[model samples]
Target: MQKCGLTEKSPGQYVDTIATDAYVWYEENWQHDEYDHSHQRYQLTYVEEGYQYFHIEKKIYLVPQNHVIWIPTGKEHRTTSEAKTVNLMLVLFKSVSELEFYQNVHVFSAPAVLKEMLRYASKWNKVLTEDTEQQIFLQAIQNSLPHFCKESSGLQIPVPTDSRLIPICSYINANYQYHFDSDVLADKAKMSIRSLQRIFKQETGITLQKYMQLIRILKSIELIDTQQFTLSEIAFKVGYQSLPAFTSSYYAIMKTKPKLKR
Candidate 1:
């Protein structure tokens, strides 16, 4: 996604609010590009299946299955997914208050109930009001969203202000899910414990342990949200030996539990 002034440019026309929903988009456009925007009535998304990649405010991200990209109000952001991806996206303008809480960007897992609503909302163009079936699905979607938008605090690691942590930061951003620890990371940065620790937090707004925890939670969210991984599998995958500790930390950050679908 490239950054620009606010305005979404799409070749196809979308459903207007009176017709069914404010908008319901389900299609594949490989070379897709959306113009920038300051704010909108509502923005929500669902990843049916596929590998989702996005670069919001210059930071690259992976949005996998059961993923929801909720762009609050109008924060200029752009995104695209590759082939082999099936997604359901909806924009509701009539009810949501006009407020954008995120100044930068955030990536969050779509809760289970919202995932089900995406499945339902994808059924028709404006089935939301038609009472075709699951008429309450819209309410479910709205209710499931947080009353006050969360600050852009999803899985994000700070870039070292010191400039020395660049290589290591890149590695961690690229390999957060892989098995590695501070010693290995320190080696990658060509620094020892005390030096790396001092610079890492000063630049990143977090300690090494906290930073690793962020990586662990991020990897876990991707697995739990997109790939079909049991929490136990995710814990091990993120280098957590004790499942209970990982669970506690995950909840502290996401405020949600991990429950993968069968």
Candidate 2:
């Protein structure tokens, strides 16, 4: 292993100077609400245990355990982990060969191989010298990232920024577990239902109904992660009156059935 050269520089300064290829770290019992910031390096954050909510631009992604969030270089974002105990493996690459996958932010399912590679890479948590084994190994991980990242988890919610739509969105987010008609949202926004639907689609790129469904599904993922509720209970908790309705909507978003974390 290459010896770590610890420096007194700030986090940004250290990453900018020391990371020639990749900088890696494994954080246990990690919980933080980070400020909005951008990085020069492409970042991969793997959630080994708890979950994190990543706000990238207008979208909020729920990155649950056994999953990874990839943020391209210079993407403005912030992350909040409300879970009391979390394990995260974070890797920042100066650059990678896969430009397509590195162009946008995505959440992908982390396979066992990738997780094991991350565990091995965690040991080399500092700046790596060129031509060293550590650098080569880290490079391999960077190369494999794009391949494994193709399977997206589809756990994101797009938010609207329009002032007229803000309250409606807040209402839906807060009451995602209850069924409400579009009229309620229209009343909240002080707009006609037709106008509300149009502006919501224009700003969020999805219909108001779809957005509400997305919120419900997002909340369901959180509830599922807790391992405290049965699927039926979670379905009802997230506003679905029946299990089949919940399963159908969940499949539409996640492309898979909800897995109980037993």
Candidate 3:
């Protein structure tokens, strides 16, 4: 595995092939380039910090901090980072039970114990020397897999396919600080207000306003984790007129108070 800083121009990347029965473990602390690729072995990717986006089958899914994304074999996907520095753990191994829990791409929350196990597994990037140790690590991870399936948190929002609605989603993501109304969003999508609402729901299975709120809360969480901005600043930055409203919405979605760590 190579260790380097990733930039917008040149992002760091690593790929390992599962020749026989092998499990590859590595951690990447940099942004990744966007490209469509596939591997023969099952992949379990955990985001330790920062955010990552995956574009699969024309839909984009946001993988936030402390989240895990499971990609099955032969699934062509493109990945990119939403932040400048993204710390990610990549585990590639063969598992017959890959489709037992999830058939398509899935994301779940990574509990503290699983996080430590992944960190421990990151040491075996090149090869596992001891068969007994490898079995122990594999058993530990498999035992914890059922818990992950039960505690799966679907934190992803699928990008719409309608060309008209694409700009509206992009506008909200880029200018999330601005107060938006359905009229403005309808105008951007070049549709009537009712049409906009109906189509957004049909395409994304979420109301426009609710989707915007989800975006705001997720963005605020990212900002809060950075510890670079105060809660008030983050509130305003994500388009809340007041801190109370921001806090209320944060609690509604995240079930916790928004705090900025110094």
Candidate 4:
């Protein structure tokens, strides 16, 4: 909570770091909220833990661990987290940036070094510099980024044509209010539990349970920010059955408690 707090982001409001093309915020307790973006900005998010959904181009992308989702300039995008999520952000503008030569979604196994670099950035330490030395450090990250990943071939999931997992996925999407487990998901997907687990990790880079958490976190975030329900109301709405469990999960994802206005 000490490191993750109000400085990161606040509901219905946005922070502008006018001085630097880079901005980073780690909400140790970065809770759920839907935010609208304007002008043009690109983001590289490392999901330290928890779940997140990116609403972009009429598609919903579930972002999980070692998992990074990048949104390019002028793209209408929104982010919501259900778990206590550690968010490492590298936001840049088209003008002051060198990433223009690259485009489209890039997903690679985040290198241990890049993970360390992002860890440094997400520290919420305000002492970062655009100094010649610091610039090289940052550039090293940017230059090395586009190469680690080849083109996606427009596939987010690696489900085989013969895979029967779609039915299970559809059921989970429809019944997210209920608790999900590997056995249940496997039954629904009509694959052996072990195979379902393997394919899920291969396809989404995370387990089925992780994806479910992302969905719950997204639902909780929407309700909390919109005030469509009281804390307890949203808790049960997202299948927590209790406020403490929901809060615990929320804080676990965001690394901070939801600020209640007096």
Candidate 5:
């Protein structure tokens, strides 16, 4: 396993100097299947090409392209790639006073300026020899952190821990393009419709119907960006029976109308 961040000389030891502890790098085809772990420094990850999923606690967050995911120090989390080739720019640094506001896991849109800065920093993964040059480099990243912290709505789904719901979720992920009837899902879970509904809501914090819609919307985003299908065709392919309903649902979840990239 190739870790990109700087390894501390001593465990659990807080260092005061920001110049020595900070690390930055860019990676391609990055995939990690490690168990949940935490570090002493905060991690800022920007997805430049493909999508990635982060498993934190009981929730799963989907981070798409041109977005950022922030992990605070000592927060246990793990990441998995959603695409075959995922590109990313990552930074690991000590929590400074200016960055204290980002103490929780945050997923947001990355501005162009921050993206460029990260790209520039990734070019030199080693510490600079000159004191003045190192100070200039570190200060540039520090100044841009506040600007990149703007919050935008991102997709996050609650993962149910109940054993019975495991297969149900897997089936939905594999066949979200087909209509999912509540009764069928209830039968699969070996529970009555009402009992299944109550347990699903209690465990995942969302209704079964809403969960299916969210899955469809996520799949629609990928299809809209990759395939040459028309919006109506894409809607039908993602299990939406009516174009208006699909458009309305897309707007509600993505906060924008679905459009193909020219």
Candidate 6:
């Protein structure tokens, strides 16, 4: 087996270039580079322990523990983790059958059976050849993926690509913990309030207020995972002065109230 050596550019370049049908790559306490790249094979990233952030274009998706992020073939994206102690397992497949689920990026639940399968498959760090039991096993896992991916994590937020709206999105992302007013946002975009509303919706397909709410909820999820703050504290930290208002907004997007882990 030819092991991939560390490169100054990107540690994943070696594995990404491998010419194989199925491969498993597991990392513990891994720190990723900021470089953006794409893979030829379809990739399934199982978050074995901590959260893995997937970036595609201007959107960012957070895949937490017991969840898997499916990245289709030829989709350019950047993946990184923020946890000090994180475990991630990557399963890459080539020549896979085209299914609706496999056509786009998704962050879905990883079932218990799939988790066990991934753990067992982690032993085979390199490529698995065809007609062998290893390949057969991997094929079974691939077949079972869609069944386990029925629901998404709903942790993604997209930034607008329009030059006029770019600074506006950046400001919301940076200052999500603060209340945003239409006047402030319009001023930030250097446009009138009416034009700002129209152009922002046309560019992002969501209202500017809705976009800010989504960012706030997304940030709240990250803060909730740390388990250091109470639910009220989290609400305030994420720009909600009233706990009920924060809870309402969170439930509206997440379909559940904000609660801290005991």
Q: Largest lDDT belongs to which candidate? A: 2
What are the per-residue Cα lDDT tens digits for candidate 2 across 152-241? 545777778889888888888899888788888889899899999999989978888888888898888778777788999999999999
Candidate 1: regions farther than 4 A off? 1-21, 27-42, 46-54, 58-67, 72-86, 92-152, 157-163, 173-187, 190-195, 224-231
Candidate 5 structure lDDT: 0.76
Off by over 4 Å in 2: 1-20, 126-131, 151-153
TM-scores, all candidates, are: 0.57, 0.86, 0.82, 0.50, 0.78, 0.83
The worst-scoring run of ten residues by lDDT in candidate 5 lies at 8-17
Q: Which of candidates 1 and 3 reaches a greater lDDT?
A: 3
Residue lDDT tens for model 1, 220-241: 7656655556788888888777
Two-way lDDT contest, 2 vs 5, winner: 2
Q: What is the lDDT of residue 160 in candidate 2?
A: 81
Candidate 5 residue-wise lDDT, 80-125, digit = tens: 6646567888777664554555677878778888777777776666
Model 2 error, position 52 (Å): 0.8
Instruction: Provide the RMSD of all predictions against the true structure, rounded to 1 decimal.
Output: 6.6, 3.6, 4.3, 11.4, 4.2, 3.3
Model 3 vs truth, CA RMSD: 4.3
What's the CA error at residue 227 for candidate 5, in Å? 4.3
Instruction: Sort every candidate by lDDT, greatest first.
Output: 2, 6, 5, 3, 4, 1
Model 3, total clashes: 0
The window of 10 residues in a row where model 3 has the poorest summed lDDT is 3-12
Location of the lowest summed lDDT over 10 successive residues in candidate 1: 1-10
- Overall lDDT per candidate, in order of appearance: 0.58, 0.79, 0.71, 0.58, 0.76, 0.77
Give the number of the best model, judged by TM-score. Answer: 2
Error of 6 at 88 (Å): 0.8
Q: Per-residue CA lDDT of candidate 6, range 135-207, in tens?
A: 8888889888887876654577666788988888888889999876899999988899999999988877788
